[model samples]
Target: MGTGWLPWSAASLASGAVLLVLAALTLPPTSEVGQVVGTVRREDAAWLMASAAFFLASVALTMGLPAILTLIPAKQQVVGLVGVWIWSIGTIGTSALAAFLILFRATVRVIDISPTDVEQLGQDPVMTLSLLFVFGAFYLGELVVALVLLLASRLPRWIPALLLVHIAAAPVNHLLPEQLQGVQAVVLGGGLMALAVRSTEAWAALRAPATR
Candidate 1:
């Protein structure tokens, strides 16, 4: 059981790391806001498409975490499962948003739309609402998962602590230097990888015959 989940968790973490790197690299520069159309064009549609793909992959991988948790001898499995479900919802919402944004960008590039049109699109109520939902779901899910992990004791002490710090720092993350923003994703991916390895080991030990 643990062996089966390890691959999924590792893949999820890897995909998340790639998505973070792509976001940091491909995001439009702050100075380019006035030139929205140019900024949109400046972004590589391939990168956006890749990000969407990774986002979906990460979401799929997350589903396996709860199953892995169920194997652990812990009383708080329900809490952890709830967190996983919440995170899944957020990841799915964000994945859809990522896909939609990619398609929208491709359409804009194909039509060679002007900055004014881009601005108008941004102002559209539906777009604004979608953006809100995406961000809201993503963050809320992250927070819940972090809290559950912290309490569940299934993961290492440091893993949940790091995740909590990452979540708590969200509001001020932008205040830090631009280069530091991507560090969170790296830390998260590493933590997930570690969790996967640990889970695999635990499962192996449980399955092993007693030496005596």
Candidate 2:
């Protein structure tokens, strides 16, 4: 297919990154299972729901990122293909996680959970698996994408560097003080926006000679 969607996809990806940042800002912190349950109970439902909704929207909007990056001219085509496949896994995992969060929020209001429920929540296979995705697939995919960009793509050096920084900061974001939890999201969003601008310029450059 032609790259007519390149600019549009890039724009959507940037918008999704911004929304992901908002989701991170609004999501309640969790130190313990009990605390998480408490947050679900005590935090404003709207806020909790918004976090999930934004996350879902973000993932949905940016699902084409792997494709976009793969289309960029690269020194190593095989490496770019590998990166795309790896990031695709991460996309799937993140999408599942987002869906889980949305379902959790949707059901929480109707279901009554006692202390017993909280204890079981940790052991529940669905929840455990979802949490596992955070540690492994979700971040790993982005890490590989950054590496692919750094090693393969002809884009400016800063693009991959910023992505690396964002990936490094994301997992640790919750450990930061409440005031600074959104920093990773901002970095990621900025990087994605930069990528979008670069893509737009590259598209124009490619079409410039054709227009002559």
Name model 1 segments beyond 4 Å from true. 1-32, 49-53, 67-73, 210-212
Candidate 1 per-residue lDDT over residues 11-76, each given as its tens digit: 554555455545544554443335756656676665475556556655654554543464344576
lDDT of prediction 2: 0.67
Best by TM-score: 2
Q: Once model 2 is optimally superposed onto the true structure by TM-score, how far is the C-alpha of residue 203 displaced, in angstroms?
A: 1.0
lDDT of 1: 0.62
The collision pairs in model 2 are none
Residue 18 alpha-carbon offset, candidate 1, angstroms: 4.5
- Candidate 2, residue 110: Cα displacement in angstroms equals 2.6
Give candidate 1's total backbone clashes: 0
